[model samples]
Target chain A: MQSSYFTGVTTSNGVMQHDFTVGEVTGALWSSKRAECAPLVLMGHGGGNHKKSPAMLGRAQRLVVDGGFHVACIDAPGHGDRPRTAHDEQEIAALREALETGEPVGPIVVRYNAHLAERAVPEWRAALDFLQGVEWVGDEDPVGYFGLNMGTAIGVPLTAVEPRIKAAVFGLHWPEALAEYARQITVPIEYTLQWDDEHIPRESGLALFDAFASEEKTLHANSGGHKELPRFESDSAVRFFVRQLVRPSIPQPDLVW
Target chain B: MQSSYFTGVTTSNGVMQHDFTVGEVTGALWSSKRAECAPLVLMGHGGGNHKKSPAMLGRAQRLVVDGGFHVACIDAPGHGDRPRTAHDEQEIAALREALETGEPVGPIVVRYNAHLAERAVPEWRAALDFLQGVEWVGDEDPVGYFGLNMGTAIGVPLTAVEPRIKAAVFGLHWPEALAEYARQITVPIEYTLQWDDEHIPRESGLALFDAFASEEKTLHANSGGHKELPRFESDSAVRFFVRQLVRPSIPQPDLVW
Candidate 1:
């Protein structure tokens, strides 16, 4: 199994944040300072966003502090501290131009994010391998994935092949390159879609949600544009993780001790 | 300006239940014992269910105890304590035969429920008028309506004509006769749909959700058959009402006292 190299650790508001690296991947882990062991949740940051973006930190805080689970987020390729390649620069420029010119950014975003997913999926698997090896972040129970927008672009493929991830919260992406992967995912899913998304068509969001093969999937379609995804959804996702991870049938030896 | 005739009152588990009548319409109200006045939520029970069915009582318990709101439910015409007419009996027989013979019950249920809605809508208005007149159940803020199946049938039209309802939680019914009324309703809405419902087609549910003219609406589609709606949705609805009714801007004068 690949090993993660720990760099720094900090505690704030009762949550312990650990900075770690797996090969070239840069990530941060947040956990309750008091819990002995908890299920792990891997979150993928959006395009142009870092692992510790406010959205990621906020969700991680809830997962760690409220859910009593270890949460980790890795910066997507060409984002955050990672140096962007010439290809990344070119695609980003095109996307910016499309947005500035009032042209549809869907094609460019779908094409670019799909490329990033190809690279990030392996990094996520390796990170999980290293995270589960830690005594405090045991692999006895299944892990979960929560991501949206560009995060959803990468998470769909990651959750598809990652057997360790038993549940996921994913949405706000088109099905173009992701629906096939979504169909392969059979774990419980909580998906969010904006009813009046300016970029992604409503049908596209619904279609992607429909592609998921999970027997226990939920689609939460709110009446707003993409970025206006309500804050309450974050709380709902945390509760979902609690229900899926803290099952009464499973004996949590780690939690007991 | 009608007055409610109180028939009985009981308290259990920190909740107060009031049995009342407006003219011939019988109903029950639930509220927290300590709170002087809170927002009111009117619930419509499912077909073949009474005002205080298990679903109604359980939801009322949460709304009253957890949400700090008064909840009321009335017996639809020819339901609960009311006597069923010959027409009601014939329709009931048709629905029962369809269910027992493994035949489609949608047509019969839709036709019968629509008939009930016509009678139930005015009764609900009278109940609301009477309930609002009570000292403890103030009408300062807009009320909420929650119902599914037959409840949705009654609620769609009731909400259309009753401008006092600012929010509603509706689902588990076809659009058929309800879509026109749904379009007239511009209040915030939370709708639920079973992905694999046998009676209602997926498109039918989606279409009904689409018909709502509410600018702020949500569709929660879960992967389950018609009778398998997850219990957590009830909690979600309670939170939604809290967001709508207990707003920061709306000075809750009733709650202050």
Candidate 2:
């Protein structure tokens, strides 16, 4: 197996960030400056986003500062620091044209993200292997996955196959190809969707949430467009991780709003 | 309008309790022992429950101690200290029979709660009128409603007509009688329902949530039965009120787990 190693490290706002890579895949790890061995949360960025996107950084900060958990996010195949293949270019142009022409983007996003997941899931497992091997991210604590949109695309399959992921937060994608994977996932889940999502139909979003076989799944459907997923949801996701990853054993930290 | 006055006062666990009456109606108010002028939250109890039920007290404590908000709950007509009418007696017996025979209780609960709402709405308004008259609970700040099951039935209608209620957290009831009222409500809302509820159909729960015209509504559907709503949801509701009521002016408080 290819090894993972840190490329650089930076600290800001009380969070220590380490830029790292698992073979060719670029990733970032976030933890409190006052770090300790804690549970790990693997976050997946959305379509057209990278490991250090503002959304990813903000959520990582919350997980680190509030949850006291080590957080990591890898660039999806053809996203962020990764180079795109000819096939990836073709899908990107097709998605762009669909958006420009007022065409339904669900089919294209679903198909393209599904294809990416096949490659991305294995990379995530490899990344997890290296992450768990690290001294700060010891394998003793259960791992968690937090991702939405294209993140959900890759995460559904990864969590389905990855027994190490005890809980997940996923939403904002079509269920056409992912329902099968979602069914295999029996861990606790928190799924979010937009009630009036312009890109994804309401029924389709609900269908994906319904497909989760996790006995303790929760669906948070907010009334808004696809991009209007409230900022507060990020806070809620932090709480979900705190509840799922830390509990009866550790004294839970107060959630700083 | 019937005037309301406090009949008794007590303090426990840093929460000051006030027993008050509005005409024949009985209700309880909860606040921090170190009281101040702050936002008000009107919480409603579930079916066969009263103002100071365990659930109500638990939630009220969170609002008062955590959110620094005054909280009040009134006994529904024919509940707690109120006398039951002959009609209330008949409905109670019918509901009991349905439960014993493994018959569908949704229809009976829907019909009974709606009838109760007709009387309960006025009493709630009267209680609010008196609550706002108190110096500590001034009318300047927006009011919030929190309730589930029978509480949702009464709260939906009460929120529809009460212009002071700017936000609400309601759920766990059918749409048959409340849909019309829900359609008229335009405030922000947080609704909850059970995904695998034995008593309420999943679609019916979704449908009731659908009828709400609030542009900023959220549906929190968890995987559980009618009575198995997770306790953390109460904490979520408190945060909802803090965000809706506190805002860019008052810095949000830390959420203690």
Best by lDDT: 2
lDDT tens readout by residue for model 2, B1-257: 57668999999889999999999999999988877889899999888989988888888888998898999999999999999999999999999999999999989999999999999999999899899989888888889999899999999999999999999999889999999999999999999999989999999889989999998999999998987787788889999999898672565333210
What overall lDDT goes with each candidate model?
A: 0.89, 0.91
How well does model 1 score by local distance difference test? 0.89
Model 2 bad stretches (over 4 Å) = A248-257, B1-3, B248-257
Q: Candidate 1 docking: what grade?
A: acceptable
TM-score of 1: 0.94
Weakest ten-residue segment in model 1 chain A by summed lDDT? A248-257
The TM-score, computed over Cα atoms with residue i paired to residue i, of candidate 2 is 0.96
Pairs of residues at least 3 apart in sequence or in different chains that clash in candidate 2: none
Summarize candidate 1's per-residue lDDT along A70-89 as a digit string, tens digits. Answer: 99988888898788999999
Cα distance off (Å), candidate 1, residue A164? 0.9
